[model samples]
Target: MESEIGAFVAVATVLTITPGLDTTLVLRAAASQGTRNAYATVFGISVGVLCWGLAAAVGASAILAASPTAYTVLCVAGAAYLIWLGIGMLRRARNRGRIAQTSGTARMGSTSAAESALRSWSRGFFSNLLNPRFGLFYMAMLPQFIPDDAPHFLMGLLLALIHNAIDVIWFSLLILGVRLMGHWLNKPVVQRGLDSIAGGVVIIFGVKLIIPVIFS
Candidate 1:
């Protein structure tokens, strides 16, 4: 059991640190609204991961994986959503100059900071939730950490918590780093560059999700 937990932690750590939508969203939130918003995005993303992990524990992962049509449908939806987000980011980059100044107001805007935080949180949640593979990732990767005959409920919950803990830690670091670069992130040229890069990466992922892999 101990060995399995350790292995799971290592695997989760590697995956958590890998660049993905969650990381992108956290960085975007932090860049746009500072550390507080970044934390909110990270929390929301953690919630999504937890939800999927719990669902995987209950065998929903198999159900989704078993149905190619369902998986395809989810892939299309998620891909479309990502593309939309990319477009939005690009638009923000194009019109950043029009936005109100953030001289020293903690990046507040027309609405309260709390509202922006909630929006960031939702972005993280949906970004993860929409990926059908995420449930399967938990279903597949997490079981490697459990004894074949072990009771899955408590064990699953524990693994889920560990995964989320990794998430929080990595994203916290992202927020901190972005906070340190707060000045650079909000600059017009830097913002445009980020928008272009993030947009391209997201669009590529979206395409990857939808494209069928051919085997000889």
Candidate 2:
């Protein structure tokens, strides 16, 4: 059991550090919106992760994995959502000047800030939730760590919690790192550049996800 846990931790750590959509979203939020917004995004992602874990524990993820129709539907939906989000970010980068001008208006600025916070949370939540790959990962990989003597659901939840803890710790470091670079990241040009890069990466992943479905 101890050895199993150690292996799981080792693998999870590697996964947590690997650059992916989640990392991009969190870093972009920290750089552009501030730590509070980034943390909100983190919370949303945590919730999504928890949901996936629960689904896997209850064998719901098995159904998803087993059903090609269900899996394809989820994959397509996730891909479309990601592409839309990427395009929106690109559009924002393009209109940064106009947005900056609008921010000077007090009433609109406050409303925009509130909306932005909610948007960040929702974006993080849905981005993680909609990705069928996450469900597949939990379904295919998490069970290997469960000891046969232990209750499957409980063990699964515990493992999920461990994964979430790792995520929070890693993301906290990322947020701090981004905050440290606030001086440079705060510059409009730098912010736009980050947005462009993140948007492009997300769009690429979205396209990659859909290509199999498109051709198959």
Candidate 3:
């Protein structure tokens, strides 16, 4: 059991470190929004993982894996959301000059603290929640780690916790790395560049998710 748990953690850590939607979101936040918002995004993503973990542990996420209709619906919805989000970022990049001029005063005044946090948090949360992959991944992966002799529910939850822990740590490090390069990363030009890259990547992910459904 101990060895299996260790193996699970090792695998989870590798997956957590791999670049994905979560990484792109956090990178954009850290580069453009500031430290507070970046951390908020990380927290939201962690919460999202926890929700999926719980669902998987209890076998609720089987709906996503077992039902093609449900999976298709979620895939389309998630793809739409990602494309929308990416478009917004690309627009910001396009309007970077005007945005830089008004960003300090107008931007802060237009968006309240609470609204900013909520937006950032939701970006992270929904980015994971809507994408049914998390549920499917958890469903397929957790069972493999749990011992037949152990309680399935308890073991699954434990593995999920380990996965989430790795996520928090890995994302925090990413945020900190961005901060360490803040001087250059915070520049309007640099921010726009990051936004463009992140936005394109996000859109590609969205397109990839929906392409199979379209062809099928």
Q: Candidate 1: misplaced stretches above 4 Å?
A: 104-106, 213-216
Model 3, residue 102: C-alpha shift (Å)? 8.3
Report RMSD for candidate 2: 2.6
lDDT tens readout by residue for model 2, 1-216: 887778888888998899999999999889878877798888888888888988887789987768999989998999999999999889877877566632222122454777777888888899889988889998888888888898888887888888889999999999999878777787778778888988998898899888988998
Model 2 regions lying over 4 Å from their true place: 101-112
Residues 8-73, candidate 1: write the lDDT tens digits.
899999999998877877877777667878888888888988888877777777877798777777
**Model 3: ten consecutive residues of lowest lDDT:** 100-109
Per-candidate Cα lDDT values, in order, are 0.78, 0.84, 0.84
Rank order (by lDDT, best first): 3, 2, 1
In the order shown, the candidates' Cα RMSDs to the true structure are: 2.4, 2.6, 2.3
What's each prediction's clash count? 0, 0, 0
Clashes of 3: 0
CA error at residue 182 for candidate 1, angstroms? 2.3
